[model samples]
Target: MIHPLNFDSLLFGYPVGKINVDQSWDEQGFLEEAKTFQLVYIFSQSELKYSSETVRLVDIKATFFKRLDQSADGCSSLERPNGELDQRLVKLAFESGAYSRFKVDERLDNEEFEKLYRLWIQKAWENREILSLPEKEGMVTVSIDGDSGKIGLLAVHPDSRGKGWGKKLVKAAEMQAKREGAQGLYIPTQLDNLPACHLYQSTGYTLSQKEYIYHYWRN
Candidate 1:
């Protein structure tokens, strides 16, 4: 069932309504506002990931479809890595030794890989609006399951816990998936992750199935 949220007014009709951005954001207020709109912004980074540019999270923002109708422009509010604002941050991540752990190809020699990577990043930014947080960051990739819809991996940093960040991330993913006509969203976690299990259940998701794995170690 769709969660309850507040509605300002219906412009076109039901399922094509607007959110009252000026409305207050108390827990109850947000819940009431959320019921009216199919899409809701859970949490945003406020600051552009790469720049000091600031946008008020509470500002009246239109749905992607509505905005597209008005502008018919390819340019997006999304901050892709190519733009001047994002390039700096991308450079920093590459220079810092952090990308090494992920084994990201530092050598940007492959034009095809770069193109695919940019598209992947754009899709991910499009999927998750809250890219500012260091903890519970997620990446989107094509599914090996050979599906049309994308698969997401939300990884929570070891230091971050008890904050419900991962749950918020999953909610974002579900919204994106629904928007993209996905059957459902799936996440895989180890059996030992009790906290993760609770988080998933709290957000109205259940364990659909489990996988068994055998690891062979060499001494």
Candidate 2:
């Protein structure tokens, strides 16, 4: 059934929608539908594998979490940030490592991307736990699905990259999950984001799975 896909699309109208399926999904059926709809996302997932890799859980009293400041984030992205769409973040997502695997036409333009981010941002805030590290100059959003803590968004300023802010926020997310009593934390990223993937591994996130994200557009 396409029920899962429908739910994701309804939540935020993300120009590109994503759905995760394990080995049990109808592979041949999906391929057949791919011929009818535009397959915009594709990736694979794996169980997180690691040994004795523990992240240093640290939370400073000086650090705190707050609501998202769309205005501030928009300014960082550009002068006029669209209130309707989180376009600023969408543009940065363009640099994603997995994007190279996509067909050019499958990608959404800025306007459409903004709609997607807008929907995701709203949902992340409404249902998930979202945090911003002002001290470290970064942002991260997380959600708990079943026993896992899922990180929805993680971003740091370009100027803040090498200073360990990314890892800090990642560690913070881990701590957040622990406080909520999750068994483990799950973070998804593309291959092109070597730095991010490395940060996760170093911070103790094992390679759980690498999957393809394929999107279908009915037009």
Candidate 3:
């Protein structure tokens, strides 16, 4: 028999009839992690607003149209539990630049790292598709200026839409950069992503500059 409270486990594809029980500590940690990422995602945009109607836990299976076991997941294995790859990627950005800039050596603890991972899973469980680089296909971060840096390949899961997490994430990144003494952070995305534009604007990030990114190659 499944406990009603355990229905959320079904969000992750736990069998319908089985009760999903977890340690209190695990639950607490997961919530904290989710809150942190949620905060980051919520804060990233100048225009993206937090709305309960937009951000809600959804059926992962319904959106994927497959068993939870079948989806192809991509994430940064830089942390244990290893799914909230976005956080890791952002952390990597800070590490690559912050280390060079501040000369500070810091890493997230196992618990903190795991918590971050759980946040990713929660977003997925809510139906968002995390678009990261192909596995083992090295990703890159570039310094934008003396006071800024940028990361490519950032995305929210497909199923988790309408929550304004995108803007939140941008805001959080900006805050993180400022705390680390960065004047700002920069990102480039297609102009068609109106939602993204609204998000960036709502969160105090602006369209400071744009340029043509031409990819010419001889094959």
Q: Per-model C-alpha lDDT, please?
A: 0.35, 0.48, 0.33
lDDT by residue (tens digit), candidate 3, 1-219: 122323323332322121222222232333343431211111111122222332321111100011112122222231122443455445433332321201211222223333433553344323322222333122232223466544332344444446554544444344433444455466664444455556556655567544221110111
lDDT of 1 by residue, 1-219 (tens): 223333311321233122222223244444454454533333321221211111122221111110011111211221212323244223222222222211232222334233433444454444443232421132222222222233333444444546555655555455544545554556554445556566667766666554322111111
TM for candidate 3 is: 0.33
**Candidate scoring better on lDDT of 1 and 3:** 1
TM-score of each: 0.36, 0.58, 0.33
**lDDT of prediction 3:** 0.33
Candidate 1, residue 81: lDDT: 28
lDDT of 1: 0.35
Q: Between candidates 2 and 3, which one is better according to TM-score?
A: 2
Pick by TM-score: which candidate is best? 2
Tens-digit lDDT track of model 2 for 3-53: 234554443353333445566666556555444333234333432221221
Per lDDT, what order, best first?
2, 1, 3
